[model samples]
Target: MDQGTQLLLILVVLLVLFLLAVIVFVLFSVFMKRKNSLLREQIETEKRYERAIAETQIEIREETLRNISWELHDNIGQLLTLAKIKAQNIEGGEEMIEVAETIGTGLNELRALSKSINPEAINGQSLIYSLEQEVNRFNRLKYLSADYELLGDAVTIDSKVEIVLFRIVQEFMANTMKHSRASKLEVKVQFKADALEITALDDGVGFDSENLFEKGIGLSNIDKRAELIGADAKISSIPGAGTQLKLIYPLE
Candidate 1:
């Protein structure tokens, strides 16, 4: 080959190799970008699915509670009323009078349970009002001495957030009643300009707080629900002191 021809061929080969390298680099960048986008989309889809499931579960549970409340009010409550009336009619017997009073008390408790179980009690009213009713019912039933206090001016809260918070409080109360063997439970709520804080404390037998997440699903559930609402949950306990759960939710 002639020197000029050889030089020209070399130049052409170098140009071709450079074009190939550029094409491969561009393709790799595109592939990486696509992979990252897909990953983000998948993560979002999973989050949405989890949120939907949580909402559905709450709805079903509330519906079932409503049904039970109705049955307690209309059926068992009536039967107790009838028994009390019959007991009242029995004269010259102190035992009969006591029986009537007992029946009446039972009737009163049923009515309260009915009101609490109805989903409307929480949905139709504010969170503060709902918590007040729950605390009153607990005291009336003598299940446990429960108290609620509110601080600061309350701000309007989203309904979804209210429901989730109410459920979380209920879970804590249930745990206390069933296992804590505590005589008193107190709940405090503080409203700030841009956030809200809730603290639930029970003077009961407390467990190890360090392993709370590993203990059971109930504790983990509290964490999950709090996260869904962009809140932070802190649970602490002392073996002899007590168990306390605090949740802080940003309003904005």
Candidate 2:
């Protein structure tokens, strides 16, 4: 072949090889992108499944609580009332009067507990109303100086989110009453344009928020549940400064 023709042929071959390399690179990039996209979709699907299972479990738990509440209100509460009546009727002197009074107090407590645990009672009303009932019960039972305040205008919330929020507050309150030795508790609900904010705090001894899992407080599970509901739970605590949980739920 002539020198000029050989050079031209070599240039054409080089160009063709370069084009083939580009094609291979493009195909590899597209394949990687698709693989990554599929992986993300799979992860999202697994998360959705997990959330669904968790929600189902929560529903079952609430149902059980409702049944227990009914038992307490109807059977146990009725029995207590009957005993109180008998105690009041017997002429056992001042001791009998005190006994009757005590029984009456017990009956009131049972009624409060039944109402608190009943999911229908909590879900049948507004979130504010349900929370108000909890705060009132605390004050009535002298469990603590509980206070509830609402900020901004009240907004309608999904029933599922409302129940989860209420349960989270209930768990925190129970922990405070049973372990925190807190004398005062405060709960605030704020309705903003874009979201709902709930804050619950107790003026009691606090623990390390960083090591919450080590303490087995179940607040971690609360965090997970909040995420499942597309809410954010931020729990903070300092020794002697008490504990606080701030939940932010987006309004849809």
Candidate 3:
């Protein structure tokens, strides 16, 4: 080979290697850009979900307060009115005793319902306390046998998160009472350093978890509300083994 021919071949080889290196860099840059865009899109979607959940929570709380007001007026108020009439009637000692019992029962009902009427009260309290109140209400109302347990040291969580969590559990309890036909229900709350786990189990006639979305709007809402607060929800049920729901919320 001549000197000029050897130099020309060397330059061509160098040019080819430079072109390949440029192609590889461009491909890598494009891939990274696409990946970053996808990640940003995911974050935005989650933010939207959280906002929707918050709005829904507010609406639900308002409706709940309204219902509580009606119950106080229509149910407990009527009981008090009857008791007063019985008190005014100087008929018999047995009649007076019945009126006293009625008054006592109404007072008990009011105390149980009072804790659930205020969103601020729920936010100010620990999640475990809120769950215990719910369980007590179920038992008091003769809806079902409900119990709650708290494990590990309690961690202070965001109030907004607590409200959402409480609402989610409330929905589950309502379902158990109305549809589960189950006699007993249990709720367990576990607090860890990085996360909080809530588990609810009911010994009721269970349905297919795989088709939950098709089952009822309440179930879907329960899952979505948990996700709004950056929590993971898992629901499982067999034909007769009863339904179990687990939610895990990570701490900041």
- Each model's lDDT comes to 0.86, 0.89, 0.82
TM-score-based ranking, best first?
2, 1, 3
Give a tens-digit lDDT track for model 3, residues 1-252.
999999999999999999999999999999999999999999999888878867786668657875785677677767776776667575668877677777776666775565566574576787778888888888888868888899999888877788888878888888888778999999999998899999999999988888888877257777777766779988889978999989999977
- The model with the greater lDDT, 1 or 3, is 1
lDDT of 1 by residue, 158-200 (tens): 8878877887887888788887888999999999888899999
Which pairs clash (backbone N, Cα, C closer than 3 Å) in model 2?
A: none
Error of 2 at 55 (Å): 1.1
**Candidate no. 1 TM-score:** 0.80
Judge candidate 2 at residue 125 and give its lDDT: 78
Q: TM-score for each prediction?
A: 0.80, 0.84, 0.70
**In candidate 2, how many clashes are counted?**
0
Query: What's the lDDT for candidate 3?
Result: 0.82
Per-candidate clashes come to: 0, 0, 0
Error of 2 at 21 (Å): 3.1
RMSD of each: 3.4, 2.7, 4.4
